[model samples]
Target: MRQERAIRTRQTILEAAAELFDEFGYEGASTTDIITRCGLTRGALYHHFPSKESIAVALVDAQSEALKAPERDLGLQSLIDLTFEYARRLQADPILRAGVRLTVEQTSFRSPGSRPYRAAEDAVYRQLQLAAQKGELLPGLDIEETTEFIVGAFTGVQLVSHVYSKRRDLLERVSAMWRLVLPGLAVPGLLLRLRVTPP
Candidate 1:
């Protein structure tokens, strides 16, 4: 179908762009590079993305795709699972890698730099809210504050893992992060049930 083909073409362009962005950062990767990498005509790249910034924005937005965790009970455990999923994807997904790269190097693009962080924090907040209702969270813990801290911590951990190990140790780093963070966030009993390692 035409729609299917269009969707595939758009994904192809995005993936090719993601590779370039991952390799050279946002400002370093150009439209010509994406065209050459994808072996697509200039018109095709232009048709999908009007400019390099647009492609950067698209890749940055795609960062959320890495946040897709399997459905589970909303609790501290689910939050851990969500983070582990993100770490695992960061190790393996090129699109996510590029999105993260663009997000971290936001000054290179003309898009809103905070958008991706806001989206990620929102997801964390949702899980924390549900965990609160389930009595899995620690008493008197502020969900918003905890969400912000957790997202920030994960960001830092992943950045370090990427820098030192090309993210090869990202899963282990995230597991360690949860071990340090869960005690403050989860109720003592709930902590016993939580699994920090990636599934």
Candidate 2:
């Protein structure tokens, strides 16, 4: 049970750090402050995370890990489901929200070449390629361009919504995003088969 307790303690630290990072950007949230927030001693915090940058890296890893779509057949719906699920999680999960913030807003804690963003793009690209193979993508659609667009549009929508209303309308904005983009991405019959409003 010692191992179990250690795991729980580590998770608590990460969660507390995420909350603080969400409230104040990465540079704003200090390791000393995080230890106090988690109600743990400095030694305990150091045992789990040697430095504040490691915590940020952990959050970025968590962000990429949380973005996968639920298991489903390879098709346009899979792509839609992946995006909608990520949107929903971003709305509800503070950890993920904070992770994205750290990835985007951190200046001092510069990671190597925006790994989190690349991971996000890769996840979407893999699914899009599968959809193409399954005959769900529009004929002559450039898979690379489509993948880039999916990641960019989603990121832009979330950033804009966060600025305007702190993401209170994220789901609605994502739904509207799909409505506008889906027509160009799929055939009419395929569009009819997809659910633009969240899966």
Top model by lDDT, which number? 1
Clashes of each: 0, 0
lDDT of 1 by residue, 117-142 (tens): 99999889888898899888888999
Local accuracy of candidate 2 as per-residue lDDT tens digits, 24-130: 88889999899989999999999999999899888878987776766676467777787778888888887898888877773888754668778888888888778
Q: Say which candidate scores most in TM-score.
A: 1
Give the poorly placed runs of model 1, Cα more than 4 Å off: none
Root-mean-square deviation per candidate: 1.2, 1.4
Q: Could you tell me every candidate's TM-score relative to the true structure?
A: 0.95, 0.94
Model 2 TM-score? Answer: 0.94
Q: What is the lDDT of every predicted structure here?
A: 0.86, 0.84
